[model samples]
Target: MFTIVLISCFALYFINDKEYQQTAWIVLIGTVFTWTLISYWIRLQESELYNRINLRVVNYIKIYILLIGFVIAFYTFLPFSVETKNIVAAIVLGFPILGIPVNLLVVNTIDHLRSSNSNTKYTLVAGVGDMAGTVEKHLLRHNGSHVKLKGFIKCKKEECIVGEDRVVGDLDHINDYLRNNPVDEIVIAIPVKVSKKIQSIITAADYHGVRVKYIPDYRGLFGENYKVTRYGELDAINVRQLPLDETYAFFLKNTFDKVFSAFALLALSPLIVVLAILIKLDSPGPVFYCPIRIGKGGRPFKVFKFRSMRENDASTGGTKSTQKDDPRITKLGRILRKYSLDELPQFMNVLLGDMSVVGPRPHRSFLNQKLQESVDKYMIRHYFKPGITGWAQVNGWRGPTETDEQRKQRTMHDLWYMEKWSLWLDIRIIYKTIFSRKTHKSAY
Candidate 1:
């Protein structure tokens, strides 16, 4: 539709200008390709845009602005008369102003008809708790929701909070029921305390490619920003999960990490080479230290770092923390550690996909085990890929964890970071790491 509209506008503008026939074709093709790419990037085909009028309007405005910019930029380089450019701009701008509403109306009407009772989705509820009952009531009472409750899958008959007649089957029969019965969506309204059972149900739903929604029992327990994800009007939350769990968020973070790491390595090649040579000359050991550190999901990966200590430093065993004026440090190592230059090699780890450029720093296996014994949520930090620098490090939580309280505090910061992660937040951390005064204070 966009292609047809754009090409029509282009033809209308350049039909009389036979000398600019090639330019019209170029503009038409470029506009269509650009809009197509932008649509995919913003997920315009997703139902949410069509269902939410305000979102649809906002996206249209954004796309219109982009189109205007692209047209002006394209014309700036082309040998076009000022009159021709003005005509093209006027024609292109009309495409969004007039076409967007028509497109929205068509999509909205189709969606409305599709969401009728005759076309309702057969939804299955897992668990018989108050949340499950609430969900069932909501689906039944809301006519526009277009959801039909098939039945509930209870954990046990005695434990069933809802009526026995409503209980279709137990967890043991969920797979069989899903196979025999036609279920479009599965709503898991279980408590966070029974996460193991919830996980199993979710796994089954995923295996069958069925839509799964989770309603967390513990809402206020989480940070406000990390509490709920809204699908249209239905709100759900995945307990102890980060936004990165979503496909788009994961893609954004991973893409940024790869691009930034690659660029940093390229731009800093000269410095990295100088540092590597200096480290090799200062220490008897290898220039780079590849230590196994626990990364995302408790997976162990070798983290790269320029060697900043003696060949066989006792601290390498994770028995002791590096301190001020440590004798294990080489003369060149002191400077490298002060400005975090020793961590420069970790760009390689970032490029290798073992770590991120910004996240909770990874801990050695021995230290991880020791910290896990004392700190209740120490291991939660491993839920995200480890980084060369982290929120904790920038906020004065870096250096040696001399006390259990220190480790606990650092873990708290790490969890908070994961809960509130964004592209801007990562950029903020990177900026602070380079400019903040406190960043190097605890370095040894």
Candidate 2:
């Protein structure tokens, strides 16, 4: 929808640009290449392997368009007799910059629909022990999550308990069970030595149109090297490592961080002053609170916040995250922290390149050291810049780290956010932070 609208709007703009006809250079390029680009994008969807790469190529095109927009706008102020109209026409094409991701999403949805309709449903072996447990979990976690089982071809003679259902029969009854039920997948959970005996059972299921999935005694369905793949059809999204790390994604992200942070600091200067006054009148403290925090790569930096705690005149202590009923918290501090008004000043941190508008939230040095010692994969989060707000805060993990479980989950969320970082993703997190009431929760 956005694509067609943009193309039409740009075309219309070019047709009307008689005064600045020289600016037609941009419009001419867009009009001539638009259909070609659309064709190539559709071709990418027809194949499975080229889909992701092609989508990224499309992203690069959008980035180029942004650069083109800036250049065209810059040249517009120049004394262009006819060249100005052409430039304006070219700039119009950039209006639908958001269409790139939208189009890819639509294509992915269609692909998922096709993959779901494919024959040969996955089968499972409902048995006893860790192998069985792994197989069952994978089966349940599979895209459809409704794959039919032939029966528990139990390696041991005892019946297995699974979600109030018991194994009614064994490998011997596999034939009989399929005769009476719909079973098209064979997920073998038997040990390798015992697997030889179940080979015929797997063959039987395969002969009967069932796709076989072996539950390895090792670990993970597709290995521990994570790969996050999604099929839009069944809404199945797996947390996995991507083979393609996007340089363009990084470019777009840093560009957005710098651009938006600068713009926000400038645009919100007035609001900052108003909040500064409120803080001064409502309590005794400095307008801005500078807290020591760990930034990207374990570097130390001072994070900016609207002062949300009493400036203790005689108190002496190392860094500490806020907790409920802290004596140093003023009435205004409570309000500011509750609504996250205290975080506004971090835009300066973002501008200074010490933080991102969206990423893992930075921790006080004390909390950072404590968490690093207790949590696995904790330090991995420092690979990316910290943010004013983060995934954990939005997901109800914000407050004080009172419990080990709370801190563990929060750290896990921070790692997850880093692993899944992307420009569109950052934008989504920002949207949630700005609009979601969950972010306003107050806890120690």
Candidate 3:
């Protein structure tokens, strides 16, 4: 499709006038190269691999912007007459806009047909409970054509909530049953309480070389952001994890942080210098305060902030929660804290790899320990790199934790952000931080 569009674009612009042919060819090649690079970068060529329509639309929009931006930049640099550039720009922009709908239609049709005619896999369910029943019903209702439900393996006859007719065998006979029957996949929908039975079924499936998938029962547990992995041949379940934990995601986010921080520090140099001078004149302490704060994985790092209070001997004073009108706050500190200018220095911390642009805000070591004691899952927020501004902060959960409920609510919002972390979500949080009216409402 890309090649066809490129050829069509070239043909449309190619004229019999030889004087302009060279310029036409140059523009055509440049446009095609830029379009191809952007398409590959955004994975538009692999759109068929995804099943979500909304994701496909987003990919198309990204490609559209890239194409238009490339055309604008390419034309701006080319030494061509205004008339020629305008004509070339129109041709280049039209191709991608025209191609998007066609590509969407082709991809959607192919996906529908592929799903409709896909080969059915023979699947068996192990264990019988609410989770098992829910899985069975979902398969029967939504994936009926793509999956064949063989039967269920009951761990205990009395405990089996699924109908007895669907029970083909018990856990004791699972190995023997697989030895005789041909099963493509085994779905282990068992609770953690019955670990021995689940392991037995998994081992049997492994010996038979059949794929095994476990459906965890997360009742009364921190079930969000669960991931399964192997640790030296032993299966391990991760209760709290983030997409940033993956190698690609970590690299992408870290690279963005470094590049953005460098740009911000350079761009805001004038403002930073002026602020530093003002801070020194307004207070008797250093211009910058580097306080030790807990970071990702509970590692301690010095967080950078402009001095916003008077010099004090109490080391714990900085860690102690601040109120709306704390007397310790200096006259100039009020303006800095209200607009979050005090956090500008932390961009340097982001450059140093001690923080991210968007994540759960880091807390002082003393406050972290106290929060951990009061909140059971308080440390879970440390699973990701601390950020200068976070989901909780943007949602008005910043500042002093005056009550147990306030601490829990803040932690809950932070955990939700971790579980739902995405590049888009990060962008949204940053946008809200800058534009939202209530952004500075909770700040002291």
Candidate 4:
């Protein structure tokens, strides 16, 4: 609708009559206003995650109807000549006639291409019985190219029909397997009667920040809060589905991350150059420091930052946290660290898709392991990409994790942010990161 009205206004620019132009402006404003409301009500901007082609088409049709009706009715009341109205209306109404179908076709084509591409989920099955095999078959049939079933975890006394080489380990060792692997999700295919075993697996999943899903054998097995989504014809319940788990939410955040990082880097390029020169002249080391940090899915990636400390073992991967009077920090480095100017280079990490604009701050490997052992569900923070500044950082929980209290509090704040995440929450975090004194309370 906006496109139609915008094109009409542009075309009206060449017309000599001011009256026609005025009418065009009014129509554009009216169409935009109507669409703003309609889109909000229908959540037209949200990505549709329908796995079924028919369901996607049905949704597209419903949206098309609402849009077509609004365009036709909106143009009818305009004071323009009948010929003008007809031409404008035809152009507006005629668009979706071909546009919507083409859009669907293109979307499906992209999906097909993506299925064979790198966004694949590394999955693990938690049983080796009939149900487990059935679940595997369904996943293969529906998302064969997208979901890579790494292996299966066998249950005690369960008959194993799958090949012996395919079994990674048994249920008792699921935690060890998860800790050493990059698993995205664990699908429990065992019977609901094995509640204790299921709880153990769920606990391991929580500790490792891997998603847990159940192939439901009973309707009331899962709680009301658990989301029951279709896996082809089968029903699967996501035990703890965060908003970020949705396809649209992922797309929205990822898109924003890329755009925001690109813009920030471009706008701050001059400042970055100055800082780079200052760092080089201030110290005898490199301008930028790339430290190994654990990112999404527990994958290790080098986090980019201005070198805030002397080049040493600690500068890259040492477990020691910076202290207030640490001699390792240079003069200019101290000021940079105090105000977080050192973190500007991490926008490059965000641009490279290794991080987010707002998330739990990434930690060193030793710190990550220690926290996983001491803090409950600490690894849950790693479920999403790390950020340059995060909810914890903005809430005054940004410093050393020497105490159990600090570790727990930081993890809790991160989990809270994950549960309550939205584009608005991210914006608020960014605002506080820039202006709030508490955000810098722990900076040294």
Candidate 5:
């Protein structure tokens, strides 16, 4: 999306002038083709052998439509003359006309290579019925050829339809069978009503650390709004999908973080340099301080900050919070903390994808564990990236989780932000972070 938008803007100027029309077209086409190839080069980042080609095509089409829509919406915010509209339309539409075919061809070729026998996953079906046969047939299909069926397992509830020679063992010995076999995944094709048997099979699969997939037979158990989704080619159901789980939301937030962080770092280089030098003069310690903090998915990562304290035990791995007029704070450090200049280096963290511009603030590892024990659903805040500034911070829940009420309120506010996140809300938080007195009230 960034590649398309950036090229469009660059081409806009030259395309408008009749003298540079050919040059503009060449630049636009060449840049886009280069990016397309780059995207293809790293396309196997997920390392999946077989891809759902239809799904890939659908995703590309959705992205293309989204790009066109974004362009139109963006143009609406600008004052465009009739000639500008024609130039913009041609630039946007013409690129996709040439790009889509090339994209599809590459996708098909890659899909073919990926679906080869070289990376086939040996799978075991934990039943021998119509559902089991259906799964076998599906695996043999063109798209699912990457999953090679090892054999079927006999079940008391279902009559064997597959050949006797294909039966690895009965469901009761599934644990033993998996322990001695090299199965990549096990598909449970039995009825959902057989709860006890299914539980036993799941336990066996879990013990053996084998991936488990189920044939969907629980349509009556869930609401219409709860739809089936895919994990690779295997169908599964989700009760509620978060906003960030959507592709466009993830792409938009990720793009905004990278672009905003890069721009902020470049623009703030002078101030950053001056501050680094002052930190060295003010205190005899490192210019940057990195302390481990709990991040997304409860993972621990070192958070970057300009050092604002005299080197001490607390400055390293200690979970202690700074207090009012703390003795450890240096003269320049106090000023930096007052206006949050100390946190300016965290833009590098944002650029590194360890943080976001706005979300729940990351807590120290010990504090995170303590909150998990004291507060309900506290860990849900870790579902997304921690931020330099957050809704809780903007709403005056920024500092010192000393009491239960403070901890609870901060977590509740963070959860609320996750549920109600939008670009506009992020903008509001940023505005308040700069201007709101409440945001700085608890800053030590």
Candidate 6:
């Protein structure tokens, strides 16, 4: 809707050739706003992840529209030259897009902290809906999150939580419980079910004279993804399904994986050869370690890395990740692994379509098996090919996860990267990797 409105506005506002030519960039911005709104609307139809992004994008559209309007008016009234126009265009174009969400995310977090006590409160998940689970996860922001414990309220007898949170009671008398107990808000969470049952629940909330708000459920929707929408001005939400699989995101990541991996392999061939020779002399193993790793969709393939362990190192087992003083490390291997040079040859894996340049690092068979059992959404990382270096690795998750918390944090970062994956982000990560490097004291 914003898209067509933008086009009509541009067409009507800038009719003459000279005027249109002068205002082309500003009007072109309207095209972006159009697409922004449309894409959000589209993603709203599919993935729950995109819905949040769509909201951010829509908010940006508002800001962009206002800025564009001001600039256009400035150009028209001030009679600025084309050079001035170009400067304005560049400045307008350079509005920090990715940073906007990051900023809002920070601001929202700070605001939340200011308004609410830092004390951890026990949250009651209501209605067994998407919003509830989302709220539950959001409430569990960090291991040290403010909301201390979590409980649930079941709307149906069949609905139950598998996690540690205890079910408190039914929502029918939820208001009384809230009044008596120090319970937080009774968040009305409904899944993607547009039925009379949902309508009746909304009516009940209204008749009760209590404040009720719902977040849409995104899981298990028929379409590719899920989105949250206001539910008929009542304290309910509509879960709209959308095309979930992001073809563009997948394509962009894959392209980078292939292109950069191939380039690194070809360009660094001499360095790899030197490393191989060093490995042969220093260690009693093959020049390279070809460990079988699980890739996208549970496909198994040998991942190439400059050999970073002794020949007798266990290839298959449920072993904790190596630390700074791992005995398994050979003399040369220690140096190689320290600078992440041992991971260099995984460029071959990337070229083979077994991995990506930027993604969740692939786990060994033993670890994957262990984690799939432990982490709730562990295997979702396999939705895309594992990366030679990933969001986890660069962001200080380079070494083994000895603690459950470390593993969970690593997995969460990987998932966030997947949820908000973008080509530009990948490039930024790659840039950071090359410059910042994942050099940590913990990395053995």
For TM-score, the strongest prediction is 3
Q: By descending TM-score, how would the candidates be arranged?
A: 3, 4, 1, 6, 5, 2
The model with the greatest lDDT is 4
lDDT of 4 by residue, 38-139 (tens): 656776555443345665566556766776786576566656677557655665566566646665676677667667747778999998877788888887
**Candidate 3 TM-score to native:** 0.61
Q: What is the lDDT of residue 267 in candidate 6?
A: 92
Please, what is the TM-score per model? 0.54, 0.50, 0.61, 0.55, 0.50, 0.51
Q: Tell how far residue 56 is off in model 4, in angstroms.
A: 26
Each prediction's whole-model lDDT (CA): 0.80, 0.67, 0.80, 0.81, 0.78, 0.64
* Global local distance difference test of model 3: 0.80
Tens-digit per-residue lDDT, 64-115, candidate 3: 7776776677677867787668656776567555665776687666656645
Instruction: Compose the digit string of candidate 5's lDDT tens values, residues 201-265.
Output: 88898998989998855543553335568879897787545677778988998898889889989
Q: Per-residue CA lDDT of candidate 2, range 23-95, in tens? A: 4544545544654565455563243223354654665465456545545764667564455554445454553
| Residue 52 CA displacement from its true place in model 4, Å | 33
| Candidate 3 positional error at 109, Å | 22
RMSD to true structure for each model, in Å: 10.1, 13.1, 8.8, 17.6, 15.7, 13.7
Off by over 4 Å in 3: 1-126, 134-188, 195-224, 232-239, 312-319
How many backbone clashes can be found in candidate 6? 11
Please count the clashing residue pairs in each candidate, in the order shown: 0, 19, 0, 0, 0, 11
Which is the better candidate, 1 or 5, if ranked by TM-score?
1
Clashing pairs in 3: none
Count steric clashes of candidate 5: 0
Worst 10 residues of 1 by lDDT: 219-228
